[model samples]
Target: MFKIMIVEDDHKIREIMLENIKKWGFDGLYIEDFNEVFNVFLKYEPHLVLMDINLPSFDGFHWCNKIRALSKVPIVFISSRDTNMDIIMAMNMGGDDFVQKPFSIEVLMAKVNAILRRTYSYSNVETDVIEHDGAVLNLKDSNLIYNEKKLELTKNEFKIIYLLMKNSGKVVSRDKIMRSLWEDESFVDDNTLTVNINRLRKKLAGIGLSEFIETKKGQGYIII
Candidate 1:
């Protein structure tokens, strides 16, 4: 089932939308901390979002732009404002659709289904989630989750983790990691690879998974 995030602040409206969302067979998430809206969004990684324009801290446009930076997940603006300017801003800020306020649950679900079908029907790729030692690496969004703690990872950090995890019990040489990262060892910088490894290790440690990636003096690194 597709996950939908509701970013509305109004308690009544949020509850109503969530109820209808469940009836449509979708997992609905409601935001609690308005200050960390984007952070919560990254943690859930919902397929789509129903955002309200007027929010507590920052408005919907601000959060829409923030989500755009992270993923291509669809975001639909639902607000009482129906001005052309509001609609245009929503689209420009990466909103896939704009639903005016006071909409029927039937109409809302219709729009939601249409967008889901149009976007996901032609896309057959599934997001891969790799789990090891209580840590899950979300390949779809490049975020690491450990014991309920979420950490957003960079592209290289993700690639390094992927390589190591694929060969869990084996030692992956530094050169092999560099080759895997760039596909060309000659173009790889020795220092750059070390820096990325250290950063990746630090991030893992931050989530209480210290020494998750074990480094061998003469050999290389291993996750064992």
Candidate 2:
């Protein structure tokens, strides 16, 4: 069974989520000390994490970055902050998905199940590496290599680049990319995708692979 860590502060919300997580046959771990969020994560080493933006000591973004630095464990942000900037910041901070408060438990569980399946089950058959234009995407470690230099990618960045590199020389539509990245793409903001792509391009450029991913306006994105 997959272990899921809950980093939410509210007592009522945490209990609700805990009940449903157990109902789904997954072990749920909740944090009691906000200051030791990362420490708890290290001790538990959960397969996935459910985080909320408004916490006690540090915001969710800070903890997200701390966890992201060491592990690529799937993280979903659950919060009432519905602003575009909040969503974008969550994505930028390395969250795998975002759920607004007042959300249906059923929908949240669906997203959780979808992400877990994609992360664990689908990975069983995927090749460890994908190469294009002399740049190699290391699937196992989520690093991109080119000219002997390697750069680690965030979860979203890895998925976006992996999709583009897999369909190298082909125009991948925006809808397609969004679906590939977020299983339930309808809840995702359009600008969120742009933010991920731009961040990815900037990272690629850092390794001297400037213009590695091109924008094919009116269509989508391409890597050629």
Candidate 3:
């Protein structure tokens, strides 16, 4: 299922949109802390974003620019302001579409589904690079670039860092990491995974990302 992130601040509207989004068989994600919108977007990596014009701290346009610098994911503006300038600004800010407030949920869903189909139907939507905290993972080259230094990674190291960076604020368990490696035909056992993690950490530290990935006791590892 496609994941959609809702960035509206109104409690009632946000909940309502989420309910309908889930009802339509899509995974809906939202955040209450508006200040962390960009970080949350990076962490979740939603396929599309429903953004609002007015927000706490920074506005939707600010976050849209921030995200646009990183990924080409679709962003649809949903707002109470429907002026010509607002719509133009939304488009200029990299929004794929705009839906004004007091709008039909069905219509919104239809637009969302249409955009998703058009965006993902005939192409791979993953970005060429995944970046966090100044470290850029070049998917095409399997190189980790930090502070103008590039470090080549083995297949297993790439996969491990990809998973960790993709899920940046969450703990990824050892079993999950092992499963991912196994799917890639690496066949890493528990001890092997530990070794890989250690090696990857050392490489990251070498490139000025020391202590980037943290161990979470018995749970797993997290890149926060």
lDDT of 3 by residue, 1-224 (tens): 78999999999999999998887678998889998898888888899999998999989999999999989999999999979999999999999998888776655766676678779893543345666655777778999877568889999999999999989999999888888888653555578998999999998889888899999999999999
The alpha-carbon deviation from the true structure for residue 142 of candidate 2, after best TM-score superposition, in angstroms, is: 39
- Local accuracy by lDDT, each model: 0.84, 0.88, 0.86
Q: Which pairs of residues clash in candidate 3, taking residues 3 or more apart in a chain or in different chains?
A: none
State, as a TM-score between 0 and 1, how close model 1 is to the true structure.
0.54
| Pairs of colliding residues, candidate 1 | none
RMSD of 3: 15.7
Report the candidate with higher lDDT, 1 versus 3: 3
lDDT of 3: 0.86
Q: Candidate 2 at 36: error in angstroms? A: 0.9
Top model number, TM-score: 2
lDDT of 1 by residue, 1-224 (tens): 89999999989989999998887678998998899899999888898899999999899999998888878998889999989999999999999988887765545665676578668883552324555655767667888777668889889999999889768899999988988788777876789999999999999999998989998998899998
Each prediction's RMSD over C-alphas, in Å, is 17.0, 15.7, 15.7
Query: Model 2: per-residue lDDT, tens digit, 117-177?
Result: 7789855433445666557776779988776688999999998998998898999999999
Better of 2 and 3 by lDDT: 2
